[model samples]
Target: MLVPLYNHTVETPAAFFLVGIPGLQSSYLWLAISLSAMYTIALLGNTLIVTVIYLDSTLQEPMYCFLCVLAAVDLVMASSVVPKMVSIFSSGHSSISFNACFTQMYFVHTTTAVETGLLLAMAFDRYVAICKPLHYQRILTPQVMLGMIVAIVSRAFISMTPLSWMLTHLPFCGSNVVLHSYCEHMAVAKLACADSMPSSLYSLIASSIIVGSDVAFIAASYNLILKAVFGLSSKNARWKALSTCGSHVGVMALFYLPGLVSIYIAWLGQDMVPLHIQVLLADMYLIIPPTLNPIIYGLRTKQIRERIWGLLTCCLLDHFSQNS
Candidate 1:
């Protein structure tokens, strides 16, 4: 039994749900319509985040600054998932050409990796503001922030490039079907006929390079944050600092938990993720964070709440004046 199990190869793979649709329970109709709505909301939601932070000079600080970077990462990640989903649902076929699949895989991983690093950056930003206020300006200057980001992004691109290249070299002689939706490294790697041990090792390395480094940095940042927040002289200042970092904390948890789960299910669990569930979770990372992050942050921030109220009041006044 062990021998057969060890020697077995997966031949036929098919995802249960159609892509780019909403309401996963039923047929493609609802899923397509739902995903369409999600994409629209993700686009508008993250765009508003970027625009609000950009348009308002008051929000140009390090906290909101990191948010702008988050919004950008969300946009890239959303673009990778939403369009392909729409294509599959609208067309009734999940047919991604080889090049397109790899391209999508590359960017999807890139944004996620970028987000992981960016979250650490934000955490460090908070630690500085609370822990070392004296050196905050010197530590997180415009040139410094920009330079750090450039280095992180370039590093992510360089590190993940080998995984994609390694994957491209692998031969897919058997099932072209990717078990779960999208060309996930694990999902696609399962199809490779050659020795994907290197690819698998690379996957472990990639996970460590991205998640491991980010987690370590984030842990260090938060440790300093806890120490600093506890030392705050003012009660209100402590609360304010905590509130500023809350959305980031939430975003980090949401992004990382599922990611850790996915890596487990893909490499260790080995096809245990029911196709439908995997699709839902796959899209959740893309759809949920982008839509919810702004709302969470806006509701939490006094400035954002006041701005939203003011915008609504202006719209109502405009409508009444026009009609009257």
Candidate 2:
């Protein structure tokens, strides 16, 4: 039997210690505060988006239906990682049991994959609305929208299951310390005593293929949308069409840019990027998009904005009437 590091005789660690960020121990308090605020914003914003869409019958179109799915995904994605990360940052160190760690890893990756699918769906939604306006309703009926949602959720869970299973099979006779705040797949896989090359390569390839394919489809969608928009004879009509896509584009950039950076940096090895920087990028990639998505949509989408504003006005009026 091989002796383990850290004076352990077991082949696998019982729990993993999460260090919030390498070399940033002294800033844990500040980091915790910032992360907590972002998590709070993400929770409230996404919840509000879901509630608003649900309450307003007028907002039951395909686009708003897809927006509700995106908000739900954001809620799950942020919730899976942020609370534990906040705990780690606040305590300076946190230990998660092996099962719990793997569970978190599964949720994080699964939700991420689902969100990617949702973004692609939204892009397709836009493409149809812009390119096939006359047939938009016929093409994206309630039944079809439901089917798409089911497909997205099913594909995400199926694709991410193998990755989690592969990680759980690896021997962890070495260190039990995970160098990041959250239990990321690569970060946890690196702690295994066994040769983790297969896991790493699988992760890199799977992530690249999934993200790359979705991005290509989304790009192609926008390309056709822009072409159709520009082909409109009236400047106002072109502007109107492009404006509808602005929020989706902003949300996409916020999600994919930092995510791509984090993915590639992990693939390139920690030598090129500082470990702390990599961790921060990973954190921001998950946190920032959820925090800003609702805000972007609320500001850019007229119907959602009007519904939100109307709700606020009603609440304020009720409060004043009661007080007076």
The C-alpha RMSD of each candidate to the native structure, in angstroms, is 6.7, 3.8
- Model 2: per-residue lDDT, tens digit, 128-247? 988999999999999999999999899888888777777777778879899888898788888877777887888888888888999999999999999998999999988887776776
- The sequence of per-residue lDDT tens digits that candidate 1 reaches over residues 9-78 is 4332222232332335356666677778877887877777777777778877777777788887888898
lDDT of 2 at 206: 80
Model 1 local distance difference test score: 0.72
Hey, what RMSD does candidate 1 come out at?
A: 6.7
On TM-score, the candidate that comes out on top is 2
The numbered model that scores best in lDDT is 2
Clashing pairs in 2: none
Instruction: Tell me model 2's lDDT, rounded to 2 decimals.
Output: 0.85
TM-score of each: 0.80, 0.90
